[model samples]
Target: MFRVTRLAVPVLALIMAADPAVAQDPPLCAASSDTARTAAEVIAAVAEHQCPPGSRLRAAMTVAGQAVVLQRSGICAPESVRTMTIRPTPDTRALDTRALGFTCILATR
Candidate 1:
């Protein structure tokens, strides 16, 4: 059997609270150097978010070694959802809000 660690929830919750746009659900995690693989992995990670009750990938964008994804809810609301970054090590996988490192909540104009 497989289970999400008790740890992942809190990390994702912290990411969610970092942005009002992400408040409707917890963030998802996806990582890889390849964009296609990142999208595939991200689609798989959606369940981790417990999102929408019904949702699907509407679009994905890769920028600066990360994937910025959008999801369409069952209620038809579009969300700027999970942000996944490619890291060379698990030690670097932790999300932060700073301008200096790998962050799920990257600042965008």
Candidate 2:
């Protein structure tokens, strides 16, 4: 009886550990919107502003049905491009205007 009890306990433990419903969700942001804004266009847009020389501008963009966070790093005058990286928050479900970097603009749909 003792041996039987130990064997049954192990079997019960194995059965309890077989749950398969736990799953993970996919990332909210995919590679689809990475190309929405080219580096050159961002630089040109910044240059058109009336800020001081060598100053930069922060622009917000809506992408792929979400409000993505955008940050402009530096100016690349020769290449007509500005280094910008987008940060998509977890709850960016709307296309409303939010502060992106230093400027607030509506994201593209």
Candidate 3:
């Protein structure tokens, strides 16, 4: 029984990690309607805002003349990064992330 329990623990952990449904949800942030003019401003605003315990900061912004569509997460971290996605044309949609688990704080500039 002892040997079986030890093996089961690792197997369960692996299963949980592999399955999105079984995996823990990413932390959620409070919704905000604040807008920032630049990416730097957005980063700074997110950094300054405090997240509740166990939650993290996230922001989505549209900058004028910025060609790439960027999605940024983990905004509260000191070294947050942005992932770029190239669309056929610039995405001019208002930043709305409620359906993506958390509502993004900052939207279009």
Candidate 4:
């Protein structure tokens, strides 16, 4: 018979968390913008940056007051999908790559 103790639960959790597969970083996203005003402009900012040709902006949403846009390129290998945030300025909006800094996200596929 096996008995599970309270301490064992946390230890097991820590061990599981340390697993490479689970702990690995997610896919990264990047984009940049010069000047933007409307949401459409913000979304387009990514395409202007480093997005592959024929890639399109799939979705745009505001989370916790932050605007995020997702870009996916069907033509690109690995079918990479990326997302970037559009920050509001006093005048127009801008996508700041420095803010994200190779930030990773779960595969959008």
**TM-scores, each model vs. reference:** 0.22, 0.24, 0.32, 0.27
CA lDDT, every prediction?
Answer: 0.38, 0.37, 0.41, 0.41
Q: Looking at model 1, which ten-residue stretch has the lowest summed lDDT?
A: 100-109
Clash count, candidate 2: 3
Which runs in model 2 stand beyond 4 Å of their true positions? 1-36, 57-86, 90-109
Question: For candidate 4, lDDT tens digit of each residue in 26-46?
Answer: 323344332323345544554
Q: Could you tell me the TM-score of candidate 1?
A: 0.22
Off by over 4 Å in 4: 24-109
Model 1 spans with C-alpha error above 4 angstroms: 1-37, 47-76, 79-90, 93-109
By summed lDDT, the worst window of 10 consecutive residues in model 4 runs over: 97-106
Error of 3 at 105 (Å): 14
Query: Candidate 2 local accuracy as lDDT?
Result: 0.37
Local accuracy of candidate 2 as per-residue lDDT tens digits, 1-109: 3456657888977776675444332222211233234435454554454234333234443342222223333332233223344555555535433332222222222
For 1-109, candidate 3 gives per-residue lDDT tens digits of: 3456768889988988899787664465553323323456544554466444345434444543321222343343323333333232233344432112123323323
Deviation in Å, model 3, residue 47 alpha carbon: 2.1
Residue pair clashes in candidate 4? none
RMSD to native, candidate 2: 16.1
* TM-score top scorer: 3
